[model samples]
Target: MSDEPDETPRLDVPVGMFEDIEDLKSQLAQLTALVEARTGGDSAETVEAVSADEEEPAGGDAEGEEEEWQYPPFILLLDPPEYDDELRGLIEWVEGVLVPGYLGEPSADAKWCHRWFEHSVAIARLHAAWLAWQELTNPVSCGNTGPSVWHRDHLDPALRELRGAAGPFAGCTKGEHRVEHRLPSLVPSAWTHEDGA
Candidate 1:
């Protein structure tokens, strides 16, 4: 067993298996906004580092060779012993599986664990939000509005992003892990609106 300390982040909202329709819509909207925010608003992280060779200096320099391209800074993800081995792999994984997937990429090659981890995080967030929304909107859990519900759309973009990076994950159907309980279906086609037009 890998003693990864929860290798996942907790969601900030509560969720329900069967939520009211309006509340469900609300949850969907929330998911949409959150995903849109996390995905860096449509731009994507590049894939250069993942494919780079050892002799290929961080950049081309006569000191090896080339021009410089700058990227904005953000918090780094890992902080372990081997910065190169552990860190670069994570950056690539995030770039490949998690980041690309959430940013609305339209493929599906991200591995199963990647898909599973991202979905679970979103679910946890939805549930957390549901809890908070309930407190503010329907305090006391009055007669008609027990607890607000969650929508799956909010989580769809991330899956799409992952799909674009990797492609359809093969073991996605297996159901023998804790994370499986939290995955939202990745079938975007199934939610298309009707009018037959």
Candidate 2:
């Protein structure tokens, strides 16, 4: 190796790095704005200050200040109005993103219910899976294997249950949607007997 002060004008940085950084900055800005709107300018700074290593004060929460929940609670735990709203968003993601991207070519072996919302079991399962996906796919806190973990641990099982024969969509077919897929009731209903029995 000759030590003759090479003048090749080498470029060290990878291409499109600045663009990626700019995109991240844009996302952060949008998130900050959303936080501002949600908190009504009270805890706007909290978004910018958010970090994995950040610690709360020793004195606990400040006087007259309530601590905020970072994310929405489980969909099942939400009240009617909140449940409706969250369900709408979840439907958007499931229909617009998840099905189109992850769901392979449809067949008799792997069935998908077009009217999936009608199935309570499917709703609960998909909501849980979606929540896991949101947490696992967050780039800031999650490692590179986050998506893989989500797919293996959360998504696959949910899909298997929803699409497999004898699953939630047992009678559903690609050509036709079955609206009356009902769960068997093991216990007799007391109200059905009348006289408040």
Candidate 3:
């Protein structure tokens, strides 16, 4: 092993170093943005070079420039305003990218709800798919096979469930929007309550 001045830098980022999922997600998002901004192309695969000291500056800039909402864009967790803001972005991707690029013909058997946001399950699942798309499509993290992996692992299952007969859009048709789509019933509580104490 001849050491002729090794160039590639490395760091040992501790597992579970963050306080919560939000913090981890925030750091990752910041890192990805910084890499994208600096590199300008999809070649920055050496994420280990980012020193712990350098981490804060990236995150600091993100706080001022980007949205404060660091958590996963889960539909239910967000307030009305945040929901509206996030949903708008999600819809843009869904319409511009997912629907046009990914989806095939929608038929009676393979359904798609016109009013998808109204259905909670669809919103949740689609949001998850969008999130996966964002991450997997990024070249820095996933490389060339990212989209393929996303299609196989994320998109396929999501679409299968979403477009299937028993999916959230089961009642809806190609031309007609179902007025009311009922959610699956929850299992009743097994514990029995005694007389008022």
Candidate 4:
């Protein structure tokens, strides 16, 4: 060995690793397409349809040009949980905007409420828990008893209900081990009906 240390970092991937990754990606895309086709719903098409339903034609003569599709307002609040300012903003938006807006609408099916992971109500609750988690884990904030208070008052109870055996994803799994489960959307009819009545 030479006295001089090597400065460059080396990747020791197998020669065929890149090709294997590409093949896996291709398989995933195909599987995604298959699932979309089976469900009779594509995200792009759904957005387009929702836009068409909500928009008014500017003029009858403008039909020659394609209309720009706009996503539903709920899409903005459907992001996965995060740990930064984005999570704080999402918590505020969900609490101040989404919760109130959803409450004003007709009540959702109780049967479908079991599917908490797929529902807006559950998302809002989960966001609240994530916010609490941030406060509890922060070394400089929320006091020393913050974590205890959060667990006793918020996180434990919420998680107990949300992840219980009788919870929304009850049919999806029996315990902690993940199994193949076909979870319908929060709206039963939306997933069941191709016309989306």
Candidate 5:
């Protein structure tokens, strides 16, 4: 109610707000020191002032900088079943789940590499496929395009080649029909017949 006009600016804040102001100032000072140490004090202030969005070049130079192609890291199964059980599980999973789920109804014309599960290559491929399935189906990791990407990039091609007519199980069939087949060996034969001299 004094005639003299108030000079101090009034601020609306909690009563104890000033008590934490010193602590906040101490924290800010420590953070600034840490940043200076990490950056060697060279242009640290400039780096801090520049926003992430504003850091990029505003010209075609940015476009010219091509990002290096990065393949996703291969993730192996945590507890792969024992060899015999592994093979059985793999075959069961592929036949029961992957095949029907991804490729739809198994065609009589297309043959699955029946002996495919026996080979190391098939094991590796199936393992990769299983990992991809896990990643795409997982709620936390599966984003909007994850499923489509998995189908396009991994599932379709693998299933197609795996079920191709001339694939690993070329002569094998889903029916009871028996087909004699054996993988050709690359090593030269050690046995040589003695020539009659």
Candidate 6:
């Protein structure tokens, strides 16, 4: 239940449900492929034909691929700038800059994407809350910013409530602490001391 004006409903999801299903499917497929590769006993001509079938389609156009090999990276664009050139620049940077920045060589079939995406959602939400705190709380670093002798100082209690309602997934230890530590660094502040003493 957010107080924000938007009426979008939030959907809670399990972390490992998709991963488990995918792992089972991958294992079964690989096992079947290994059995066929061993039992078929390919001759030189058969191997050449299989290799040709594995190659890019006859048209030589890389854009559209056949159903047999279809694992393309998605280019998702969130609200881009007003200029068309800038949008094209964003797409180019995603392809040239960001994709190549990752270490190790990767082909279209074996990109290092899913490995980096598991905990990304949690980090994104935590960053959003941190940004909200930074904007709303004056005295961003340290000073009499957040608690100016007036407004009901329920910030800490409110944070505690927010932590509890987030519905942390199973096997996640100290999710609240991870969220709380984003507020302040290694120094004691007004929020650290109890009773505002």
lDDT (0 to 1) per candidate: 0.41, 0.77, 0.76, 0.52, 0.59, 0.41
Off by over 4 Å in 3: 1-69, 184-197
Clashing pairs in 2: none
Per-residue lDDT tens digits of candidate 2, residues 48-156? Answer: 4554215655556654133444264677767889889999988998998789988987677888888898888888899888888886786543546679999999999
Candidate 1 vs 6: which has more TM-score: 6
4 versus 6: better TM-score goes to: 4
Best by TM-score: 3
Q: How many residue pairs clash in each candidate?
A: 28, 0, 0, 2, 1, 0
Task: Give me the displacement of residue 99 in model 4, in angstroms.
Answer: 26
**Alpha-carbon runs more than 4 Å astray in model 4:** 1-121, 174-197
Where does candidate 2 have its weakest 10-residue lDDT segment?
63-72
Top lDDT model: 2
Q: How close to the true structure is residue 107 of candidate 2, measured as C-alpha lDDT?
A: 77
- lDDT, residue 130, model 3: 88
Flag regions of model 6 displaced more than 4 Å: 1-121, 137-166, 173-197
TM-score for each candidate, following the candidate numbering: 0.18, 0.58, 0.59, 0.30, 0.44, 0.19
lDDT at 166, model 1 = 33
* Ranking 3 against 6 by TM-score, winner: 3
Write model 6 residue lDDT over 1-197, tens digit each, in one string: 87786867877878998899977886665544443454464556556656776685677655445443432211222223433443454445334533465324532323232222133333233333333343345442223544442123433332233234332222234322232322436787788788835
Comparison by lDDT, 3 against 6, better one: 3
